[model samples]
Target: MAFFAALHARMTGRKVGQDRFGNTYYESRKMMPVYNRYRRFVVTANGQDPTKVPAEWHCWLHHLTDAPLPEDKRLPWQKEHVPNLTGTRYAYRPKGHLAMGGQRQASGSDYEAWTP
Candidate 1:
């Protein structure tokens, strides 16, 4: 958090809750005239990586719900949140991708070009 942002959060923002990603959420101590509600914000733990926010926290961040959906009451079928991995070493690369050694095992169904 920037010096001014940290000061602002401390001066007027009331701490709400924190999500699993270590991001902390807050609302203004008083209602704002524009929205007729207290302002809300989040201090992300991973710098500017918004993808680190889970679905439930995303809801609260966007004012989609009065509060974040319960974390423990998750349905059995629900999967845990995973941040976007694009541009990182953990990102998916096809078997033949140049970064993956540019080699892929040839199968019987593989396409072949004409020799002509």
Candidate 2:
């Protein structure tokens, strides 16, 4: 299924730019009938995770910005983007999380319980 999607995107879309992560961004060569506008999309270099897209590229992909990151002027204080790590080994696990393999730390007196 991904193969077909890639093929269709390649045939119908024009190359925009690639991010440091290797994800390639594309836009429809012609306006799409359904949306009545040109469609924009990205092909992830690693997996099917949408969060893999960086902030700059994401803006272009969602039509939030008219110019790609390369043409846009970035602020000096801007930092590089990072993808979510929910399912990976680097995913965050609180002290109480089951995967952490330890008993949950007690909630102090300030903790309040919610009632229906």
Candidate 3:
């Protein structure tokens, strides 16, 4: 996030909550001029990385829910949340991926060119 944005949020936005990842949520204290509804946002602990925002917080940030779901309210079937790792070392690399040695087993349906 930019320094000016952080300053604006801190000055005008009402702090909603902070997530486990250290992100702080906020909303405009008064109704916005054109939209009427208050504006919502997050002051990210890390830089502005959208993937770092978790599911529950994402929901609230988008105004899907009036408030964020309590972190402890998760059900037993839910697995532990992991942030997006697309650019990191632990990112998924399938058999055909260049990082995975660029080799893939030929499939039964492999297309062949017609020699008329």
The 0-to-1 C-alpha lDDT of every candidate, in the order given, reads: 0.85, 0.82, 0.88
Between prediction 1 and prediction 2, which has the larger lDDT?
Answer: 1
TM-score of each: 0.73, 0.73, 0.85
Best by lDDT: 3
Per-residue alpha-carbon lDDT of candidate 2 for residues 1-116, written as tens digits (9 for 90 to 100): 66666788799998888887888888999998988889999888876789888888878888888977673566889876768878989999998788988778676665778999
Question: Candidate 1, residues 1-116: lDDT per residue as tens digits?
Answer: 55566667778898989887788888998898888987888777767678888989898888899988888789989999999999999999998999999998888998899797
User: Against the true structure, whose TM-score is highest?
Assistant: 3
Question: How accurate locally is residue 35 in candidate 1, as Cα lDDT from 0 to 100?
Answer: 88
lDDT by residue for model 3 (65-107), tens: 9989889888989987787899999999998999999999999
RMSD versus native structure for model 1: 4.1
Ranking by lDDT: 3, 1, 2
**Could you give the C-alpha RMSD of every candidate to the true structure, in order shown?**
4.1, 4.4, 1.9
Better of 1 and 2 by TM-score: 2
Residue 61 of model 1: what lDDT? 82
